[model samples]
Target: MKEYKLSGWPELPASYQRTAYQRMLHQMSQGFVPLGQLLRVSGLGRDAVRRFLAYLQASGVLVEREHAQTPRTLLVMDWIRRTLGGTGPRRQA
Candidate 1:
């Protein structure tokens, strides 16, 4: 199975309202997601999930992964650093 990651946050048309599919896409935007997980989370069947993913791919909202780090991973790393008091780099006043 080809892995997919969000190229960026998807921008919906003004007419679009929050839906299960949109929620699925939002979860996906946080990280790379698998088809089965997406289907389960969206509460949609296989066919519907496939169709939506295809549409997102065609519209450039989703892109094929190429050794990309997921946003979730980055968030966790940041949390770890804070917990450890790493505090990144210090700024001179």
Candidate 2:
């Protein structure tokens, strides 16, 4: 993995963003994110997530994986909910 130097807090919410980034990182560490799943997890629109994902990829925070039938993001989501102390699994319906 490449090293990325994240600069200054800059009055932006670094802590808040970092939490989400860490969750994403944890997911990637466990497996990999399938295309389009970041939007749902990050609560960001598709365009924004596309840009964020690109930035993460470039920054070495994330990597793109080969396409697959089942998205590993589902497992990540469950892990996140568990980590956050949420009750029950998140429902897609």
Candidate 3:
């Protein structure tokens, strides 16, 4: 089972104007996501997700993550924090 992560904002080709790809990229921008989830959330089939991922990789916009070692709870917490704009800790003088 291979996995990919969003290295950063993708420089999409102007010709590749697809909403499904856009949605997948948006979700990936949030954090690392499995290919399965990408397919489910993007509402795209397995082949579509796989092809899109390959395209992103070939474009050098996708980087590999160290597998899905991240705990589900942590992922949820991170999502919540992002949703509420709270990313833990604060620096002050």
Candidate 4:
């Protein structure tokens, strides 16, 4: 999945005044946001997000990048979790 970070904040136009759009901008401003999570947050199709990101890119506000090490760490943690049966301390029984 793609990721985005808001390097610069730009006000959205009148036509783009939807809650989903607002939510996206809020999330983007927080830090690096993954496309999958954004999709869930917006509840819209990928095409719509693509267009939004494109607009941000054109406006010189969006940076398309990934947190390389974080995902790797998450993968290892998930594997360990699954291998250990579940989260936290396991039952003896």
CA RMSD of each candidate after superposition: 9.9, 12.3, 10.2, 4.9
Against the hidden true structure, what lDDT does model 2 obtain? 0.52
- TM-score (all chains, Cα) for each model: 0.58, 0.44, 0.62, 0.71
Cα error of candidate 3 at position 54, Å: 0.8
Q: Model 2 TM-score? A: 0.44
lDDT against true structure, model 1: 0.73
**Positional deviation of 73 in candidate 3, in angstroms?**
8.8
**Count of backbone clashes for each model?**
0, 0, 0, 0
Q: What tens-digit string does per-residue lDDT give for candidate 4 at 1-93?
A: 568989988878986789998889899999889988888999889999889988999999998885566788887777788678667544467
Give the lDDT of residue 49 in candidate 3: 83
Give a tens-digit lDDT track for model 3, residues 1-93: 466678877777764568877888888887777777788777888987887788888878897675644598677777788669967654458
Between prediction 3 and prediction 4, the one with superior TM-score is: 4
Candidate 3 accuracy as lDDT: 0.76
lDDT tens per residue, model 2, 1-93: 122222321222354366555554444555656545554556656666556555665555454545543367768767787779876666678
Instruction: Flag regions of model 4 displaced more than 4 Å.
Output: 71-93
User: Per TM-score, what order, best first?
Assistant: 4, 3, 1, 2
Candidate number of the best TM-score: 4
Looking at model 1, the pairs that clash are none
